[model samples]
Target chain A: MKYKYWRRSRVIPFTLLLSNLVYVSFGLDPAASAPLVADTAFTKSAFYDQNEQCFRCHGNSKYTYFNPVSEKDVSATMCENRVIHRNEFYTANHRSFACVDCHAAEYDTFPHPGQLRMEAPYNCIDCHGYDEQYAQYHFEEIEEEFQQSTHYTANGDAFTCWKCHNPHTYRINIRNSTSMQQSIAYDNQICLNCHSDFERFQLLSDREEINLIQKHEWLPNQGLHFSQVRCIECHARLNDSLMVAHRIMPKDKSVKRCVECHSQNSLLMSSLYKFQAKESRSDAGFLNSIILNDAFVIGANRNIILNRISLIVFFASLGLMLMHLLLRMIFKRND
Target chain B: MTEKVYHYPLWIRLWHVFNALLCLVLIVTGISMQFSEPNRSLVPFDLAVSIHNSAAILLIINYLYFLIVNRLSGNRMHYKITEKGYVKMLITQFRYYTLGIFRGEKTPFPVSEVRKFNPLQQFAYIVILYWFFPLIIITGLGLFFPEMIITRIFGISGLFLTDLFHILSGFVVSMFMIVHIYFCTMGTRLTSLFKGMINGWVEIH
Candidate 1:
């Protein structure tokens, strides 16, 4: 007892202590006890899946575009890159997924453990196919022509999709990473290979071939400083990395800007880029585009005035000199 | 026997001054026409067009007077007459300019009657008076016709062609004037030629 409290006090109270403690706690409820601090929510693992496992609605979990041969739906896996129409964007491999993945539209997660999905799944090819949709307006056709041309050979990576198309977009658009204007840097990469071959070619001719190339593109060999640079570079405005132009022009494969940007990277610039069977005038396809603009109209109007001024000045000055000469001859009569 | 020492007559001098002043006015008007804009048509367009046109006409009239008077005077240019030894004198003059002019030697081409102009003067005057001035006049007249000067003077056909001629000539003269002014300053001293034109007298040395 002395060891428990003090032996002298324990003699009077040991029996009462046991009886009162039992009485006080006998009516206490087990459910209503104060929760232990160790059981708090702050220390809990937060990966709540909302218990809505996505596979139930999306058909199958591990389905792929490659296995579409065994099944019809997954066959469209490769259909992601299938361009929809003549002017439609070349869709990359994107699959439609749950809306709560990327778009942070309404984030109610107390501690946002990860990203809130925003975009609906990419289900574009559920309607279109490569053979049915893109075969008509293929860059593949352009590349084939480029291959047959004298400018390029099959050894180049002309058949590849990444070479010609920006996979992130539905349309072929340029995006600026470094510059203010939308730059077709990879496209111009094609032009630089041949255009910058000045020092190698050693052609001493006065032809404007070299100058024209330098005029529209970058050439390190020539000491030209560009103020306006290329038409596409400035004309195309930047949207993130995407270069959208003020005018709604589709991604043309044959513009001068295209030549500068893409250069002879594709077979399209090759001498055999045309298949005479299908009428190979395809390299000239984009070049043949001539829109009658008003800028030239203004210049023509101004030139009329400019030409008249020049002619009048010439003739009037002529008459004055002649009058002087005639008078001089008449005055020489005294001699 | 009362031959005048000063060759420039009063009427010719007045016309020269008039033409020069008119050219200045035209330049000013042209400048104001393009005020605040490189190529914009503004309200001052009418004022500029009228002033430039009027000055142009006045210049042409004055130029005619100057041409007739200068030709009659036999003193439109500076020249030298080295008698029968003209070749020797010309060679000497050429050498003096090419070699001796640097050393402050006298000019071989001296002022004279009958052959008042040196080769350079004759060439320059021929270009300016014959080539340049006519180009401006034809162009100006063309423009003036567009403003209806041709309808009162020539008729419908003239009116139709006036603008065409005026515009074309104005362009030619403008180009010529640019080159002329540039060359005019290419003298040994830039201001010397200008001063010579200002007062009809230049120090021979």
Candidate 2:
């Protein structure tokens, strides 16, 4: 009986050690290693600290002022001219970068020297010198076209890529079923931000008369159509490239004919409805991409071969009946 | 002189009337959809689709009624022709339409209880009912489930093939309707066959 009790006691220690080993192997102590992950992931360097310090004054709402009256008290307003909202800066596309990378400023000092005001704003061409980097999406073509656009022609260096995309908040394309609709709306928002803004348009352009509704008076249910299709589809020249055309033209150059969009070779077939190209573009396929696109438009989606065949059959049937009737009438007269 | 004989039954008359109406609706709506354009929508696209689909379902039901009734009543024999001298019978019927009818010659195969249709009609009816109707229904159903089963077919989108076959079959059926209607005028009196359909009896001479 004493030997049996001694054997059970020895077995209990072995089982306990084995269970502990199993627990350790299966990552039972997640909390103990969490700090190590956090330290490595968010390691703060001297430059990063300087960026954080700069945001302390410029980003904080309490320290930054917009109105001239608020700037009178130097103690109240740490950032006198510009106020970068804390949340906006943190969520910006360039949030990962240090301020010193874009701006030549003193990093060692606690209070930034007054000399920082003289520094020029960052140029986009500095980092994106090589065009080949954007070959996949052909963004270089857009850059080239932007120089020839109405904005560039009028504003010259005043309008840049950052004005539209706003690197501080821009993100990669959001791909979904509604991605095309969202993209069209997003792009239009940029144009409307200035064009629809009365004060801004007056300040920017020579022509003060700006009314989007008035411009599109010819289109029936203008509001609904505008919401559905992209503005660029008509305003710009249709191309195989993914980039939106910046070459804004006069009203005469825009797509005016109903057949333009209602035909098999419609611009929407290649661009907005491109997702359907694979399935609808078969040689034996009856419909093109535009017709297969969500709502079936009559003339737009019609197959050319089917149309010809139907017409031929219709006429042939009518002709055959006419000939038979004539022969029957002639035979009756002879009888 | 002609003797009055029972030709159509009540159920058959009802089926014929309903089938005719359904086919008319289907043809009109289908053609309107085919010719639809941005500026020229004969009927709204949604309404056209709804009407076409509703009529199709009803027509299918009507077809099943025909199949069930004809089979039960043993009236399906009217559509079948005996192999012996079938081709000769068909030629005689054709000649009656193309030549003999102009000279007011008697029909080669007159209407009877057992032989409801002439050889030519039996052949035509068999082709139209057995061949064309099935093709139209299959293609129409294929279009309804385009995403799942009808996307790709024979190196082309199945939707395309479906639409093509549907339109072509519809056109042929439409032509058949015209010819069928015209043949109704070929009876002894213009209104004689129509009266027979209404009263379920024909005055056979």
lDDT of each: 0.38, 0.64
After TM-score superposition, the amount by which residue B75's alpha carbon in candidate 1 deviates from its true location, in angstroms, is 4.9
Writing each residue's lDDT as its tens digit, candidate 1 over A236-321 gives 32222111222212223323321222122221222111112123232332221110010000111123343355458767766654
Q: Tell me how far the alpha carbon of residue A16 in candidate 2 is from the true structure, in angstroms, after superposition.
A: 62
Per-residue lDDT tens digits for candidate 2, residues A193-263, read 77788776676667866789998886644654575566766776655675346565555788775545645
- The local lDDT score (0 to 100) that residue A119 gets in candidate 1 is 24
Model 2's C-alpha root-mean-square deviation from the true structure amounts to: 17.9
> For each candidate, what TM-score against the reference?
0.30, 0.53
RMSD of each: 29.1, 17.9
Per-residue error for B89 in candidate 2, Å, reads: 2.5
Number of the top-ranking candidate, with DockQ as the measure: 2
